[model samples]
Target: MNPILEIQQLTHTYSAGTPFQRTAVEGVDLSVMPGECVGIIGHTGSGKSTLIQHFNGLLKPTSGHVLVDGRDIWAKGSDIRAVRFRVGLVFQYPEYQLFEETVAQDIAFGPKNMGLAADEVARRVRDASAVVGLDESLLSQSPFALSGGQKRRAAIAGVMAMEPDVLVLDEPSAGLDPRGRQEMMAMLGRYRQQRGATVILVSHSMEEIAANVDRVIVMNQSKVFMDGAPREVFSHVAELEAVGLDVPQSARIAALLRDRGLAVGEDVYTVAALARRLLALKGGGGVC
Candidate 1:
């Protein structure tokens, strides 16, 4: 099967050709398969944000191409708006974007814009609401009146209502408490599984990426630093630290334990995984 999203030699320069010009992303190449959950992690100014904007035509490449289903999004006559619908992006703090009078209206915004039938739009609103775990009773209430977590989910429901083939979230869990963050991540998992959507998650949290994504892409200094399964990428702890990115706490501890000749696995990245490995060692009398 063809990749649902592909980027080739992509570059984006801000304030181009001026004294204050800066290249945010440079010569990056990557492809995301349909139905895949991919995580992108990097330090601030590392270009991960710039790279994701190109996924849905929000930011056109300064050079090279972003292809959705084998077609360049920037090609002449390409329907950029349609591309946006196909690749739904939820910006950081999406709750701040909510503005409709009611939660239902807010959730229905995208489908309505897509010119879907009113009945279809309503159905989508309901479905998206359920996916995000918003109560039906909340539909008639003002979006502004909802709790912080509810507002965030409602805003996400707005994007999901579009039924995008690819869901790209930039810091979707930012600013939430740990429980709220876990709930948001679980909601994302439900949407991806239910819709079979390709997901691109951009986050600064190694724990979130390690626990949630099937594949990890590391960005550093406007370049693709490492791309592999979570275990493979997080395995290079020193390299990640050198570029000013943190490895998950579990991964760091596991690495230290391994250095001391413990039997914890090489691929431990999550707290649960590390706990299991250590427990197994203890059960076997390998740890006193």
Candidate 2:
């Protein structure tokens, strides 16, 4: 399948041509296939955020190009506004973007900006609210009146209402509690399953990436370090650790068990999967 988004030989520099000039990303090539979920991982300052900002024209590349649906996003006279509508971006701590007086208005913000008719905007608001599990009753209340998790959902609903072909989230669950994080992930999964939208997530948490993504892309020193299936990437624990990124907890524990002479499993990143293997080892009379 053809990719929905492509980044070719992309490079970006922040604070250019001054004493603060610094290269943020360099020579990165990335592609996201239709209906695929790709997780991006990197250490602090690895340029993950800077790299994704180029996808929808939020940040134009210093060199190279970003193509969406086979067209250069930065092409002369290209409708960047339309490209943004097609590629929704949920920034880290999206709740900070919610500014409307009420939840309904907050969720309606995107469709309203698109100049969609009121009835169409209402329909979209309802559809997005369902995806994010926001209640219709709460729509009448001020967005700021909601709890932090609810505020986050409201912010997400704002973006989801656009029904973008591609959804990019930068640490969407950054500050949520464990239950909230699980709920957010479940919502994202359901959103993908229902809409078949291409999703890209930038997260530093190895466990979150392992559990949620079909493919993993690792970044180090502003370059693509590795790109593969979750199991394949997790198997290279030492290399990841060397880059200041850890393998998933289950993978670490599995490695420890293997070193102790138990044939548990390799690249085991999910708790449930590792639990099953550990239980089998115990039941089979193997020493723990």
Candidate 3:
């Protein structure tokens, strides 16, 4: 089956034909299968943001093609606006974009943009708000009056209301606290499961991506440095570190134990997984 999204030889240059011109993404070939969750990790200016922008026609590639479901997104008169509805993008600090009079209106913005019926829009708004855990009463309150985290949830709901087939989020939990971040991720996971949508998340946090994504793509020097499952990608610790990324904490701890002669599994990444492996090493007893 064809992938949900495909990018071939994609390149993007800022300030083209000028002395200060610099390529933010170069010759990047990537694909996301239907219903797959992919995570992208890179340091600032590594081009991750630039790459995702191409997925939904937010930014046209300078010299390559971005295909959505086997069709070039830039095909003549290609309803790029419809593409945006099909591939919802949640930008970093999305809350800052909320300008509606109330949370319900904010959440309905995307669906309304899609020209949905009034009843359908209302239903979508409530469903999306529930996904983000926004209370029913809060829907009537002005978005500007909500707290930072609440505002963020409202904005995210705005995108969720579109029910996009491919959800692309750029640092969805960037400024949230630990609990808030965890909650946001859980909500996103639930949404992905319910819709069976393809998810592409861009984050600087190795731990978050390691715990959630089915595959991880590492970006470095404006190109794809590595692409594989979490275990496969994290196995190359040295290269990742060189690219300003790190393996998950549990992976590092497991490595330490292996270095000290413990038979810990090198593939362990999650804390619970590592703990289970270590306990098994102790013959079902407590940590040795």
Q: lDDT: which candidate is best?
A: 1
Ranking of models by lDDT: 1, 2, 3
lDDT by residue (76-188, candidate 3, tens digit) is 97889989998999999999899889899989988998898999999999999999999999999999999999999999999999999999999999988999999989999
TM-score against native, each model: 0.98, 0.96, 0.97
For model 2, how does the per-residue alpha-carbon lDDT over 1-288 read when each residue is reduced to its tens digit?
788999999999988899999888999998899999999999889999999899889998999999999899999989999999999999999999898999999899999999999999999999999999998999999999999999999999999999998999999989887898899999999889889998899987888999999999999999999999998998888888887789999988887888888887675778888999989888998896
Higher-TM-score candidate of 1 and 2? 1
Model 3: pairs clashing at backbone N, Cα or C within 3 Å: none
Worst 10 residues of 2 by lDDT: 264-273
Clashing pairs in 2: none
The model with the greater TM-score, 1 or 3, is 1
> What value of lDDT does candidate 3 attain over all alpha carbons?
0.91
Error of 2 at 238 (Å): 0.9
lDDT of 1 by residue, 6-30 (tens): 9999989999989999999999999
Output the worst ten-in-a-row residue range by lDDT, candidate 3. 278-287
